[model samples]
Target: MMRKLRNILLTLLLLAIVALTAGSFFLLNHALRPADNKGRDTEGSYAYMFQTYPFLRPWVDSLRRAGALCDTFITSADGTRLHALYARATRPTRRSAVIVHGYKDCAVRMLMIGYLYHHDLGFNILLPDLYGAGQSGGDYIRMGWLDRYDVIRWTCVADELFGPEATIAVHGISMGAATTMMVAGEKQRADVRCFVEDCGYTSVWDEFAKELRAQYGLPEMPLLYTTSMLCRARYGWDFLQASSLAQVAASELPIFFIHGEADDYVPTEMVHPLYEAKRRGGRELWIAPGSAHALSYHDHRAEYTARVRAFVRRYM
Candidate 1:
């Protein structure tokens, strides 16, 4: 009877292990895989943007008609051909911006910010499509880990495209914001002036853990640990290693951190730690009242642009 009970316990343990392995794979796929609506159609995306922000239609149309808006491409270090939308300023200027899009968002989706810099502020802009989204090529999302390198490369491309004398700002929202912080940690060209991150999470691990809990009521123990290990083996990056907080701590360049007070998606609280982490260069934080997630600019367009214009000018 004792031997039978022992055999039963071993069988249950084996089944548990199998269940855990399967769960980890599913979790990894759910988090890293691209969404169905990845914004591949340029016209469709622009239409959506126009519907959401009515003012963009006329401004963007004018730029396109003027031949100031165009597409550009580059080969990444990994040999992936990346795509971006470049918009020249209405009038020639030394200021430029490399605006990054969030998760599952493409270059076209970020054209509002591009409009802010290119048309409103009279600064040229380059907006890149992060891998596996828009027109860029990749198998899976790297969160902000691998994308940071791609953004760094784009900054160089921006420097070349806008001229060496151009003072550039790297600005991103959500996942793109995380990418911007990661880029800040790395050595950058002198032309790269300051950074602006809006509603960015502290780290991939923390964000995933929050999502896991919120979605499935699961804790970050065996499941998250196993999933992270699987991610490292399959994609060359794990959640914990893709840390915006750690990267922010390492950066020496001035950074402007922006988050919406009502942001629960990335959690408004995450920005506090990231703001405190930056000890070098300089830092500023703005909690946009009643704004949600990446909607700070949407809700308070004039204020958002004004704050961004003021913050970047100090560093540039």
Candidate 2:
């Protein structure tokens, strides 16, 4: 009787694992697939974004009118044609700023940052559409793992455009921020002096696990690990290995970390540990009060700009 009971328990355990694996696959492929962002296509999405900063469109218009805007393309190492928008600085400074946008975001959405860098900060700006997003060609969204390599390419592109003496600083929002951290870890060109990451999660696995728990009220254990395996098999990358904490801990680049205190999307708690993990000499962090995910600039532009400017002055 005891032997039969053990056999039944083993069968139930195997069935449970099978069910979790199937369910996790369905959830990840359907929910987190590299689909176009519905929010960006609608004017409602930009209403708050555009309206909050009235000068954003005018700055873009002025840049275009002045013939400073250059829409360019670069082919990735894998032959994917990547798109980026470059704007020359008014003051002819060799300093370059490469802006990386978040998931499902295009290069055009980064014009506000371009304006800040080119017009106010006296630095040239390049905004790239990440692989598998916008005009860039790819089948999978790398969630900042592979995007880090693309950033290295962009750094080389910046050097090619502005010459080798150009100084570079990468600034990214959300997924872009995570990519910047990953890039900081990689041994790349010396032009990449510093990085600014706003509201970035710790890792692909951690973020997905948090999402699973929050959205579906599901435990991560078998489901998340199973999804990681699926991602490895299908996407050629594992979510578990794409860790920003490990990357940042391995780098010596100066990093300015910013996050909204009220940010539940990426969670404010994640940044503290990330900032604490800094092995580099230069690191700064700010938690904007009353702000939500990626909205620190929207809530407090002056403070954001000031802190960023100070960071640039000190590091970049």
Candidate 3:
């Protein structure tokens, strides 16, 4: 009887493993499949979520009623309707700044910077919901590769709304930071005044490696690397090659690179080398002593705000 019970338990374990494997595959397939642009479009997903989770509607409504904030839509080159928020300073300054949020985070989390620049420093802010996040278009998270185009579109929108002569500065955290870096490297983004990148990874592959090691205790190069390669082959874009460190190092634009000394998510070591590479140019690197990943802003709020304000004040 005991032998039979043990055998049953082993079979159940095998079945559980199979179920988990199948579920993971199904979730991945759903995530990567892009929605058709015509009838079943990306915007429909946002509408469904808004209807199901009505709490977000009130939060967005409150931000709009705050007087200084204006919500707008941006259309990507591929006709994707991206959602963005523009905050005008009460004092009406010509200097404009754009803030982009990271993965799984919407433009609402960027309100902290908008409040600082718009109210405290009297600078206008343009905050956009990045692709695959918030009210933006896309299904799967492409990290920062395709998000670069979304950044460019919003920058153009800002230029049109604020005029060509308005000095534009960009501030981003995590994935947004990577997107900002990629955008700054583009020749069309030259009108940007300065850039602020906080806690951004050096490459998408390295980030995946770190995450995989944490979860599975296995080398990510062989598995995650191969998976990303397959994703690129399927999506027609290289996911592993998305990065801004090399491009930013060779650029003439002023850049402020900030990272937490204790950041384990995308180690400061990866960013440190790039920061060192750009030391000769218009660059400033700040590593907060006790911060971790995205917590650098909260850990050293005063210093972070002061340094960012100083940079923008100089360029803008």
Candidate 4:
């Protein structure tokens, strides 16, 4: 009986080891892969995910028409065709703004800002659906690496359409905001003036830390650190290097950091450090009193647009 029990214990141990390994592999794969709310493998799946998610659908159809939108397609460096939208000033305008949509959001969400600039302020607005999110091509999200490259292509298109000397500004919200900050960190020769980042996170690792704590009810640092390392090992992406906090701190360009006071997703504290770091770099930090992530504009419309316009007018 003792011998039989010993054999059963060993068998259970082996099975447990296999299960643990498979679970680790699955977790790491999800952490590394681009999160497509729209499933990548099927068009029908994409449509279903979009429609089922009420938070995102109405913006695509309603917001597109409200801005008098025009669509364009640009190929990425790897030959992926990206769908972009433009809401140009009805009359001539020298200032241009390129708006990037956040994770799970399409370019049309930026049309509210475009309407403000193009209609009210006569600034040409450009909005691109980032890779794996909307009509843009590509399967890997790469957090912000592949994204920054796409933004570079969009910048090239913007420069070509508007003259090289045209005043250019980039605006981003949440993931889009993080992408904008990362792209600004890159070397650009054009007179790229100001960046507007709303509810942007400090780093990929930090963002995932919040997710870990919220979902697993665990402390962030050690588990997140280990999972991030596993993510790098399994997927060849270094979350440590995927930090906009480091990038923005080192850049010469001026930035405007906007955050919602009641935000729990990215947290309001993330921007405080970024603000302190950018104190000497012509940066402005605005915190809306009672807004959530990406709702700063909706809560404080006049203040939000005024801050955005004033920042552009001052720097660009």
Candidate 3's C-alpha runs over 4 A off are: 1-66, 279-281
lDDT of 4 by residue, 67-147 (tens): 646778988766888888776566776688888877666675565666667655788778888877567776656566558
Best model number under lDDT:
1
Error at 174, model 2, angstroms: 0.7
**Best candidate, TM-score:** 1
* Backbone clash count, each prediction separately: 0, 0, 0, 0
For model 2, the superposed segments whose C-alpha errors exceed 4 Å read 1-18, 34-36, 39-52
The Cα local distance difference test for each model comes to 0.90, 0.82, 0.72, 0.75
Q: Residue 124 lDDT in model 4?
A: 76
Higher-scoring candidate on lDDT, 1 or 2: 1
Off by over 4 Å in 4: 1-21, 28-68, 219-235
lDDT of 3 at 26: 48
Taking the tens digit of each residue's C-alpha lDDT, what string does model 1 give over 57-154?
Answer: 89888887888788889888889988998987777788999999998788899988988887678889999998887888876777888999999888
Clashing pairs in 2: none
TM-score of candidate 1 versus the correct structure, residues matched by position: 0.97
Q: Per-residue lDDT tens digits of candidate 3, residues 92-138?
A: 56788889887666776666666667655777779888766667776
Candidate 2 similarity to native, TM-score: 0.91
Q: What stretches of model 1 exceed 4 Å from their correct place?
A: none
